[model samples]
Target chain A: MKTLKYITLFAAISTSLLFVQCKDDDDNVITQETCTDGIMNGEETGVDCGGPDCQPCGLVLDFSGTYIQEDQMGRPGINTVFGTEGFKDAFNVTVPSQMQAAFQEKFETKLLGLNPAYTSNALGLDASTFTTVLSNDVLWLAQSGVTTYFNGTEILTGRALSDDVIDVSLLLIFGGPMGDQNPGLTSDGVPTNDAAFSNSFPYLAGPF
Target chain B: MKKSKLFAVIGGIGLAVLSIFLISADHIDAPAVQGTTADITDFYAFQGQNTSNFVFIANVQGLLSPGQPTDEAVFDETVLLEFNIDYNNDLNEDLVIQAIKRGDSMYFFGPTAPAFSGEEGTKSTIATSTRRSVKISTRDDVQIAEQDGMKFFAGPREDPFFFDFNQYNAVLSGTASSFNNPGMDTFAGTNVLSVVVEFPKSMLPGGTTGVNQFAPSTPMYNVWVEAKRKQ
Candidate 1:
């Protein structure tokens, strides 16, 4: 009887030990990814930049803050007008390489639709060439020489801080052979910035 | 200001590529980030004050009222302010200048060779060669810095884009034929986060050749800005 009692106690201890050593399939410990994983699986809107493991997507990326691109502006007003009301997200996110092929046809149709009497604008560019230029969606800078969005002789070279770009753009789109087709449409007449541009390095006027 | 007349336009994304890149002045158009920290209001490239330098100004997070704090009115960290240069007229970015904000400082990565290019950008982080942690100010105080022939400033500025959207809309809807002269300043009384940098013309590689070659006949250099996020 004593021998049997000792054997039973050993069996019980052995069973307890086996239970303690058993593999834990139910114990789930997830190894979280560091911010450099290049995967958006984490709380990131982008890879490693956004979520609880990293920074918030709304902050700027330079400071280790998370930011998803919200907006982009190349040449002013091009995307605003030429792009369809539904094309903003694609227009804003598109790389310039694909912009022309993707949007040129739409831009052409819209240009003619807006200016039905379209022949050649003041720039002498037909609707096709003009929209071709517009569709690429870039701001061309003259670099070494005189830079203005359009100072009559040069068209779309680049923009000066005080350049009346909206007026120039309006004229290019609406102004006909004489450079004055539609009297009222050609100028927004908000000719200059509300404040004088700084004559120094950063040029933009102070914020109100 | 007629908030109701504001263009109720939301953008569409055709390709949801994993890579990262963003740009263009599509104000109040993007449903995801319009008038928020991610909004890109304007981009300007002109001769710098020194004349030998070229300046690139990219403004974002538009339409803030005056006296707004940076905590509330500021640049979002996720967006990379990139200045893409296509000197050869091919429209491919031969060089890129990337600026990002951290705390009070703004760091610039490169005007160097881009690791990956195009709409699907490889999210490469080049170690910063230039950084400006200047004191940011609103109205009177102007913060500026210089390094390796490059000048930098990042802060709040006046909204420079002026348009008569109401008239443009009228014409679009066939309610009117043309815009009225001195019609209206729709963007009046708004502020934007501005990042201005001036770098030596020599830093720009020759379009036909490569970096620092000033080809006299090359005449035109196409410039565009992008706001990219790391993917």
Candidate 2:
């Protein structure tokens, strides 16, 4: 009976000691909150040298090219007087062969050219027998627009869907007429003059 | 017999716990220099005209505000900048050009072979015959009217990359309807560290033989730069 009692006492003490040591060890394990500001040691303060408050690092990989155009006073005019026919001619878009075929199949008319007369009426222009020579000039400007290519890739072939090209086309026609047709007008009311193109490619001559 | 067996089991558990603690202590004590390094921002190599010379640039201390330009904040004196050149066909650096800054001025040390790789503490400066030294110039090359040849600058400059970050974030969050037609530019006005080096084309193995070359061009060369922080 005495041996049995001693054995029980030994088992209880050993188990209690193991439980206490394990609990102490678990408590010492480092957690994120316990680490000082995410820094593991005093020698290194933060992930970055200046700490978390430091401004983000900057890297510039490809920095090249130059802008060409820069004359504000001699800026070109945009020609917006073009009706649908004028838009098609000025843009010089060769509809993708598939799109052309699809459009023809749907319309059932050989849509060879877009008609300016319909576009003029659609835009609510004064098409009531208004045969002004300036209007004709504006129409001509829209019909014959220039195309620009970058690195042999036709970025803006003729003048389809180009805000800058369209704006310049309108400016070329209207810029000269600003003071005459509309009195007290210095230039086109729109602010087409900006440094976006200039800063990118400095060697280029002009946006127009 | 059962009592002796129980004692042995307890002793084994104690040894296991002690071993775990000893192993973890070593990981907690990694050296500082290996722990705190960062990516390099810019690397430049170009030739100077009028002289048969070249310049090399490697910049660090990136994205600093205009206000922080003159602060005591400088390159860590201990950190080394190495310019590795593969004079032979192999990718390993056969020649190296190194620079370190001291008190507002930068000092160029060599185009020498590395004595040690991935280890700390400066090794013996390789033979004097293979080393050349130059002091950094104060003029900003961006503003300089003419660089007849000999010039080197490595420091912070306005970032020249253009990306529309706000639009990108908005798109990622599903709040934006669609990306702008031409897209927005987020990096329009920022800064980065720049390193510029200019050397004569002749000094290289192939001196502009053809407009383009096929092999990594030891004789004829195209160069790119990188910064390696000690891992």
Candidate 3:
């Protein structure tokens, strides 16, 4: 019995010592991996990553993935008038080349829905042709021309800062072939911007 | 445990500050970008005063109230402003000029070829050869930077798009038959972050002769602007 007791005590003592040694090892490990330390110390490939204790570094290039397109605008108010809630988000992201094929029919449906009497606009295009043009929401500019949005004779060459686009849009949508169909519906009474546009480079008026 | 709790508090405060800078609701069409820096209000392209050059203007963060502090309405550095030019009329961006704000200045890259363009969106990479950097204007004095005959400006400007939004909404809703005489200009007192660029027509495709010409073979360019954020 005495010998058995001595054996049991020795075993217990050995196990306790092993446990103490393991705790010391854990303390050493904690000291070794200080990933939170901003310095690129230890085994870090980047500041804190690519080490055994932290995640790996991808080594992304500067301005490599700089920005993503969250919004696209070609022509003003094309998506706003035609695209409803669910459709608006998709239309904004749709590539201009694919826009006609993807959204032309829907645009036609909305256009007709807006003006049931839309036989044709000032552009002399029928519903089908107009919607096809509108669906590809890119602003076309002539490389050489008197650049104006719509100056009675010139149309859609390019937009001048002073061009009354909203009035023109209203006239095109509501006006008949002669562009005088609904006098009331056409031309939002606001003719000019509150502030005058500068005639120089960076033509927009300075902010108040 | 204490360190982790401290990190959590700091993270929460960071997010709160970011959210305050982010909430901008302006453009009517794009619900996704409406309340963010990605909202594009208007785009204008025209013949420059130096008729040999063409001017392209893009406006974002529309309808900023005049009463609001200037710092609150400044351009978001996270958003990338891009002007896409389709010289071939393929409805694809053959060339693009990109601008982004960094530390009170706007950096520009490329009248060069885009890294990629489509519905997949553009991964903007700075073109080292054609890069230009300009100071961003904050006050009434307009700041412009000119280099190698290319002129650039990024700043706040009056919301130039005049619209009777309330009347239009009424008309669309079928509640009104027509817009009123002298309709309210919804964008009158508002401001927008504006980026303007003017470069010689010779820089475009097929104009390599370095002279502005109306040759029939010269392509009519389709232009557009996009506001992008880092993914």
Best by DockQ: 3
Q: Write the per-residue lDDT of candidate 3 for residues B1-231, one digit (tens) a residue.
A: 132332343334333332222111227455687657788888888889988889998888777777555436778878888899887667888888888887666878878888777655445655556667677887556678887789999988888888787776555444566789989987888888889999988888752221112223334678888887877
Error at A40, model 1, angstroms: 40
Fnat values, one per model, are 0.57, 0.00, 0.68
**TM score of chain A per candidate:** 0.65, 0.19, 0.68
Q: A1-208 in candidate 1: lDDT tens per residue?
A: 4345445655666666685865533112224655554444546666556665555556553344333343556687787667653676777777777888888888887676556666787767889988887888888776576676766665565787777787877787767756767666678667766677888878877777
Candidates' lDDT values, in order?
Answer: 0.66, 0.29, 0.72
Candidate 2's chain A scores what TM-score? Answer: 0.19
Please report, as a residue range, the 10-residue window in candidate 1 chain A with the lowest summed lDDT. Answer: A22-31
Which ranges in model 2 have alpha carbons more than 4 Å from their true place? A1-208, B1-38, B45-55, B69-72, B116-149, B165-185, B207-219, B222-231
Instruction: Estimate the TM-score of every prediction.
Output: 0.74, 0.35, 0.76
Highest lDDT: give the candidate number: 3
Total clashing pairs for each candidate: 22, 42, 0
Cα lDDT for residue A58, candidate 2:
40
Clashing pairs in 3: none
Q: What are the chain B TM-scores of all models?
A: 0.76, 0.54, 0.79
Question: Candidates 2 and 3: which is better by lDDT?
Answer: 3
The list of candidate 3 runs beyond 4 A from truth reads A1-62, B1-26, B118-123, B207-219
| Candidate 1 lDDT tens digits, B146-200 | 7678888888887776766656555544456456766776666677888998998
